[model samples]
Target: MKVDPGTLDWKDAYKLLIGSVLPRPIAFVSTVDRDGHCNLAPFSFFTGICANPMMVCFAPMIRGTDGKKKDTLSNIEATKQFVINIVGEKIAAKMNDCAIEYPPEVDEFVQTGLTKIPCEFVKPPRVKECDVHLECTLHEIVTFGDHPGAGSLVIGRVVYLHVLDELFENGKINSEKLRPIGRMAGQTYTRAVSDTFELERKKQPGK
Candidate 1:
């Protein structure tokens, strides 16, 4: 059925988007405020944007309850740096703990008992539990609106990468070993390493 977004409420729009998106990659983002307070959170609206400059982006929507920016967004705005930690099955529970709406001063790493280690290029620490981490500097932030459910696309350029040795093979990540997880709608998640299949891409018609 064809549905008009303009007629739907913000909550309905969010539900539709998440329901159809199908297992979005979660950016377990870590950031620090100007005063050096640490914050960790997750954003499912995350993906790689450009390979040339190694850019990635995540959208942090305004809170539907309060219409205020998340701590991750505010921290990034203040320090212009963050680290995107890949969420694996092993750390899924702790990552879920971070999704709570904590006050700005609260540290999810400490709250969840996750290990935080220093990064080389960025001020924000990395989640040691994750197999991969992308240390990034803020490239830009494009806000869509000020109301609730509005998203700000936070573009970041990866300056450094940290990957588990066992997960890296032949210059590529071993998905089976990494066992990454993806966000699904309403308290659901999908495992990337389960029931996987592969197919060869077809060559260009004339080539």
Candidate 2:
């Protein structure tokens, strides 16, 4: 069925976007407030936008209860830095706790009982339990749309990477070791280790 996206209402259109997007990676972002309190949140609308310079992005939509931007986004904007912690099956509980709509002053590290290890490059602390943590600086904040649901796309340039010693294989970290988890529509989540496949690009005629 053909549909004109421009004509569709916001709620309907948003539903289509989320459902159709399939399983998107969760960015358990950690940013520090002006008071040095840590704020953590999981955003499914997150992805690695580049590799050459190592960049990632996520948009934390405005909170529906207040029609205002969440604390995570605010902290990132103020500090111009954040830690992107990879979500895995083991950290699911803590990650969920961090997603709560806590007040700006609330420290997610304390609420979730997650260890906050000092970041080597950024001010924000990294989730010590996460298999992978990326220390990134704000690359840009592209403001788009107008409604409350509208958001500023936060682009961060990853300058440092923290990998668990056990997850490292050769120069890379194995997916199985990471046990990464992704987000689905609604309250559903998926574990990568449960599903995977191998692929190879077609060979070109010229060497």
Candidate 3:
């Protein structure tokens, strides 16, 4: 069935998008507000954007319930820094716990019992349980709209990186060791490195 997004309700559009997107990588982002209160949340609409300067981006949609910015977005806007912790199967449940809509004053680390370790260049702390962490400074925020379900693409440039030594080998991360988890529609999640396949890139003819 074909449907025009322009004619669809926002909630319906959201449902369609999430359902069709397959499994998306989860960005377990941590940030600190102006008062140094820490906030952690997960965003499934997240991905790597560029490699030259090492950049990534995530979309923190406006809260449908209150039509306001999420605490994560607000903290990022206030501090201009954040840490994106890669979600692994080990910490998946704790990561899920952080998805709850907690008050701005709530420290998710304390709420979820996740360890918060200080970053090298950013104020936001990293999740000690996460195998990899990307410490970034804000590159830009591109807002799609002001209404509920609207997304603000927060582009960040990675300034510091922390990776578990066991997961890195030969200049590449060991997928099996990382055991990353991803977000599916609704209350579902996926194991990203499970049931994998490999395909070599085809070289151009007469190159």
Candidate 4:
């Protein structure tokens, strides 16, 4: 079936995109306004960009109904700091609770009953429930689409990282211990630690 994104409505196209992108790693972002109002939210349009300078990026889209930017985006824009908390299966329910469209003054950490830990470099606090926290400074924000549901890709440079001591094994993070949760389409989620498999990469013949 051939589907043209231009022809489809925004909602339909969004659904298709989310459904096809299987098991996307969720970034439970935390930020604070100038008055120190805390905001917590989850975004699946997130990934690591580079290791040389330690960079990460997450795309937060505008509301389709009102075309306004999310609180996280606004805070990051104002303060130029934010924290990306990696979501785990243990706090998945609380993380989901943050998906609500609360007013800007609302404190999601208090609403969801999640503990917030002070970050070293950023003004925003990190979710204590999440095992890993990436303290970041805003590098850039690239916007796409002018209408409602438009997206702004927020690029941040990781300044500090806090990882649970037990989740670390040898030199790497143990997936079994991390037990990260992934996002799917329409309220669906995936357990990244389950049914895992490993495949060795093959070397090129010329090499």
- Listed per candidate, the RMSD to the true structure in angstroms reads 0.8, 1.4, 0.8, 1.0
All models: lDDT? 0.93, 0.88, 0.93, 0.92
TM-scores of all candidate predictions against the true structure? 0.98, 0.94, 0.98, 0.97
In model 3, how many backbone clashes occur? Answer: 0
TM-score between model 3 and native = 0.98
Q: On residues 76-154, what C-alpha lDDT tens digit does candidate 1 reach at each position?
A: 9999999999999999999999999999999999999999999999999999999999999999999999899788999
- What is the alpha-carbon lDDT for the whole of candidate 3? 0.93
Q: Model 4: per-residue lDDT, tens digit, 1-207?
A: 789987888898898999898779999999999999999999999999999799999999988878888899999999999999999899999999998999999999999999988999888999988889999999999999757757999999999999899988887888898899898888888899888899999999999
Candidate 1: how large is its RMSD? 0.8
User: Which residues of candidate 3, in runs, are more than 4 Å off?
Assistant: none
Give every collision pair in model 2. none
Clashes of 4: 0
For candidate 1, give the lDDT of residue 206: 96
Query: Clashing pairs in model 3?
Result: none
- Pitting candidate 2 against candidate 3, the one with the higher lDDT is 3
Query: Residue 157 error for model 1, in Å?
Result: 0.2
Ten contiguous residues with the weakest lDDT in model 3: 187-196
